[model samples]
Target: MELKWTDTLDIAIELDEAHPDVDPQYIRFTDLHRWVTELEGFNDDPERSNEKILEAIQMTWIEEKD
Candidate 1:
């Protein structure tokens, strides 16, 4: 499962991601998920199936307040 942008998997952006206050918006979301997958090494193991990923995502029933 290589991470990449596909026409079916992406949405149109109304505005260009350009900001000076913090890291550029392009860097923020561009290949954003790719980095997460790489860091988690989710693609390295063939035994760990999608069901494992689903199990990993515990439904966040609790909310945090500031």
Candidate 2:
């Protein structure tokens, strides 16, 4: 699936699957941004993301972890 900044859940799942050992709650936004952009099928503008969007993605990722 092609991912965008709005695809928070999918992105979260991808991240969770890719980095199962890492805790989403403790991740830095900078690292998150880089990881999101690096994800396969991620086809959105990297510059489109901001703190709020990243927070949403992180929150979703946390939920996915549980």
Candidate 3:
């Protein structure tokens, strides 16, 4: 499935699987943005992301990690 900015939980799950050794809580938003865009199934516009979206993604990732 193609990923979108609003797919925070799904994106988090994918990131969790992709980077199992990394801690989401400690990740920088810049790195998180890059990772999300690089995700295999991600097809959304990279420019569409904002701070709020990134934060949601990070929060979801942290939750998924635990």
The lDDT for every candidate, in the order shown, is 0.25, 0.97, 0.95
As a TM-score, model 3 comes out at: 0.96
Per-residue lDDT, model 1, residue 13, is: 17
Off-target runs (Cα >4 Å) in candidate 2 are: none
Report the error of model 2 at residue 13, Å.
0.3
Backbone steric clashes in candidate 1, count: 0
Superior by TM-score: candidate 2 or candidate 3: 2
Candidate that scores best on lDDT: 2
Ranking by TM-score: 2, 3, 1
In the range 1-64, model 3's lDDT, one tens digit per residue, is 8999999999999999999999998999999999999999899999999999999999999888
Question: Which candidate, 1 or 3, would have the higher TM-score against the true structure?
Answer: 3
Q: Find the 10 residues in a row with the least total lDDT in model 3.
A: 57-66
Tens digits of per-residue lDDT for model 2 on 1-66? 899999999999999999999999999999999999999999999999999999999999999999
When summed lDDT is taken over every stretch of 10 residues in candidate 2, the lowest stretch is 1-10
Once superposed on the true structure, which residue ranges of model 3 sit more than 4 Å away at CA?
none
